[model samples]
Target: MRVAILGVGLIGGSVGLAARQRLGAFVTGHDPDPEAMRVGLDVGALDAAGTLAEAVADADVAVVGAPVGRIPEVVEAVLRHAGPDTIVTDVGSAKGAIVAAVDDRRFVGGHPLAGAETAGVRHAREDLFAGAPWYLTPRSGSSGVVFERLTRFLAGLGARPQAIEAATHDRLMASISHVPHVIANVLVAQAAVVLADDGTLPATGPSFRDATRVAGANTTMWTDIYLANRDALVDRLDDVVHRLQTVRADLVAGDAAAIAGWNDAARADREALLAVGLAGGTAPSCELRVAVPNRPGVVADVALALGHAGINIHDMTLSPSDDERTGEVALWVDADGASRAAELVAGLGLRVEGAP
Candidate 1:
């Protein structure tokens, strides 16, 4: 299989890495930035491609990993160069516009619910989408064969592919992803107003830090996302405002019972939603821990090695010692593949700490 990745940044590079290292696909990358293209090659994510046309000329699949604002244009260009049977998809966060713009049978709108706070190719990891939800938004005219093929390919990359409509997907993302980002920025802005003069921001607790972590995100990328999905975001923001106003009224009236009830209901609802999301389409997995030196790219190396061996890691957590010289990585894999995964890690000169 041949895969062409456009805009070889974090998501694009990760797709290339996974396609090559896991699926044994011939990956080619096209990026406007030369440095990003170089990083993709250095990380074994993709081979060299002189231009976008060259990258997708004979490709079986072309993944448009450009930012939300540029996705429509890039997808159009990809469709122009892609083979008639080639499946074209995008990893843009906002999907409605892209889906509307591309009226091709082989085009499938997709958004991988996996990323890091950091951007750029330097931070790309092949395991970024492992056990993550990769949403597919196929229109009525979309080819069923293309959808099935893409789903199977995503599953091979360890991603859980879920089918959803474009409008519903946009609204859900607005509520879950975009609104939280806006709230984070607002919370941090309010905090700055209070702390600017006193310089006592250092006293903020972990709760505050965690809540505001997404504030001041990649400005260029987020600006594009906000504008593209402005309508849905505004609707969700209004709902949040209404809820806040209701809470304020309760507080002003000293209605303690109402406030308590609201909090309890919210907690219950959140727990239920989490349970449902976790339980759906979940497979049994075995957890294995491996002790290794605490160093850069150790996790990436372990993940790539496992991918090369066709062992998909469902999830992973790294626990570093206080001295930072050693750490243990707890990796979860399919129950059937656990034994082989252990052997693969052990072969890497890392100690397998416990039974799988």
Candidate 2:
């Protein structure tokens, strides 16, 4: 497979490196900054660097890694120059706007939940996305062939690919990721104001340090992200403010029981949320074989169904019949969910059975 990375920044460079080193793909890159392109090539993240059109001319997949603000325009250019069969995706955190902007069936909105505190092409690593959740936002009308190809490629790169609606992805990110960043920034600003009068800041404990870790990260990139998902972010922010007001009321009333309950509730909520990722960790792993007919959107429909039902696919492989009229998809999932996964696949009018 040939992959083209449209921006050779940290995420784009990592994607290139993973594609080349892991999948042995011919990875070409194009960056608005020539220095990023040069460094990307020097770091072995790319086989070559050139103009956007040249890079994507023959690519099987083209990933737009530009900043969130520029993704729409870059994706438009990528689609215009890429081959008709080339699948186009992006690593932008916000997917709703980008997906709506691109009306083509070949385009799939994606955001990998992987990154490093350090930035730039030089810091890119092939294993950055290993064991990470890579969300793919594909509409119902999106091409199943493109979605399947992208899913297989991402899996090869050691990333877990899951299908979700663009709007749902945006809302989840707004609540979990964006709102935390905002809180971090606000905490730092408030601390600065409180310390200004003393003319010297006191040492902070881990609580303060950890809470403000993402405080002022990549201002330019984050500005675009905040604005891109403004509506969702605003709604979440309002919820945060209302919750804070309740806390303030409890403190003002000196309600120790309410305070304890609030603190314990936070701990419980955190554990519950984290458990979602660790659900099948202790369970034995198994595979389910699904017999499906060769058709457009069939793979995507089944994949999305299982994903929406909260079944995690650890690995997958597709085997087509000699006549290409039928195929079987082998899905590796935790033993605890294998039976349910088979049930879901079977409900889709496909033949599904567990691998004994």
Candidate 3:
């Protein structure tokens, strides 16, 4: 079980740590950056470090976690060193580019949808992929032994395996990942707080945190993700724009039903979606949507306040105000967290409600 990781950044670094958890798996990392390799070795994440040639030469499984665009080059670089029995896989966010370039014997594209807002080797955590879905895009009826070996490796790391087509993976990620990121990044960019005069951005509370958390993720990684999955993202982006236009029309026309329907669906998602991390618990206490002062460190202050009151917030999201003075925050913790959060914020000599 000697594993060779091509890039030891966030995803690759986490893979190394997770693999090390397995009793017999020996993980080795290969990164072009000398500092990255040094950190991997210093932390004992890799059994050894090597160049492009040495990393995959005798490796049992080659897990490529480089950027989506770099995946092709990384896979190709390692392929030259791959042995006949080696199982080659990748954890790139997008699949089409890598899948198309892979003409090797035992190539499989896998995306483990587990990561954080943070990146780099220091952010690597062993439980990063625990219970996360690892999408496997193996061509139909590939070597059974290769897949078995791959799945055995995944199971050892505590991930659930899902078999899907490469095209399907591309499309799903385009909508689920790229589209949301595009919207969030654009919204954050266009917001007025970004152009504030005092060099002070609007106070960003929880909703802002939820909405813009991924905004700070690797820009190059996201750029590669968008380009690799552009077609599907383009299609879905058009649909989303149309949907927003429809909603805008309804709002302008003062259509009650349309507004209610939108609110209802959003409420449903906010209350439900337990399959996800936040929204899946019991019925919510209050559909609490508030406009909080947009400023730095708003989310933590609010969370601390709620914690003091023993109020449990369920799910929350923030949309920073276009204007520097105000921001909107929506939280759906538990009843207690909500009450305490509000009370604590008020106690801090800050207004609990910015507008409503």
Candidate 4:
């Protein structure tokens, strides 16, 4: 397979490396940065580096790793130069705006929740996305062929790929990611003001250190992310402020019991959220093969059905019959969820082969 990587920075370089080393794909890379292009080729992340048009002209898949603010434009350019069958995806953190801007069947908006504090092509590693949840935000008009290709490619990179709505992805990211960055910055500012006049400031514990770890991260990227998801981030911030006010009220009222209960609730909530990611890690995975006819949205239909039913598809692939009139979609999911997942796929009016 020929893979084109636009913007050979950390994520793009990693994609090139994984595609070359893991998938044995001929990877061509494009980057405006001369140093990135040189290092990407030197580190074997890319077989070749050239102009944007030359990189994507004949690519089977083009992965755009441009900055969040430049993703839509980059994607547009890729589509203009790429083959009609070329599948395009992006690694921008914010998805809603980009998905809206690029209304093409071949474009699938994606965000891989994987990165390091260190940046640049020099720091890119082939295993950076291993085991990370790579979210795909497919449009209503997204081609199932392209979507399946992208998902399989991501899985090949050793990343867990899942489908999600663009709006939902943005909102959830605001709560889980964007807001935390804002809070971290706020914590640092608050701490800086507390010991402004004191020659020796109070020593900080691990809690403070941990909370402010991402206090001032990648200002250029974060600025674009904050503005892109402005409405959702603002909503979450308002909710946080309201909760803080309630805590203040409890302290003023001397409601010791309420304060303790609040702390306990926070602990339980954190555990519950973390458990979602930890669940079924060691569970045996079962494969269910479904016979599907050659169709545009067949793969997407079954994928979305299973996704909506909360069945996490660990892996998937499509095998076409000799005549190409029919195919089989083999899906792997946790053993515990296999029955329900098969039932969901069967409900889509397709025969779930090998289902008990």
Report, for every candidate in turn, its global Cα lDDT versus the true structure. Answer: 0.83, 0.89, 0.72, 0.88
Off by over 4 Å in 1: 197-202, 283-356
lDDT for model 3:
0.72
TM-score against native, each model: 0.79, 0.93, 0.73, 0.93
lDDT of 2: 0.89
Off by over 4 Å in 2: 279-284, 292-296, 318-328, 347-350
| Tens-digit per-residue lDDT, 28-116, candidate 1 | 98998888898889988887666999999889889998889999999999998888999999998888888898898778889999999
Candidate 4 local lDDT, 1-356, one digit each (tens):
99999999999999998999899999999998988999999998899989999999789999999999899999999999998999999999889899999988899999998999988888899999888888888876577678878898998998878887888888889999999999999999888887785655778999999999999999998999999888888988999999999999999999999999999999999999888777733578889999998877778777767656556677888888999999988988878888888888888888986554
Q: Compared to the true structure, candidate 4 yields what TM-score?
A: 0.93
Q: Which model, 2 or 3, shows the larger lDDT? A: 2
Report residue 147 deviation for candidate 1 (angstroms). 0.9
Clashes of each: 0, 0, 18, 0
lDDT tens digits, residues 1-356, model 2? 99999999999999999999999999999998999999999999999999999999999999999999899999999999999999999999999899888999889899999999999999999999998889888876777668778888898888888877788788899998999999999999999998897788889999999999999999998999999999889989999999999999999999999999999999999999889977733477898888988877777788788778777677777888999999988888778877788888888999988744
Of candidate 1, the 10-residue stretch with the lowest lDDT total is 304-313
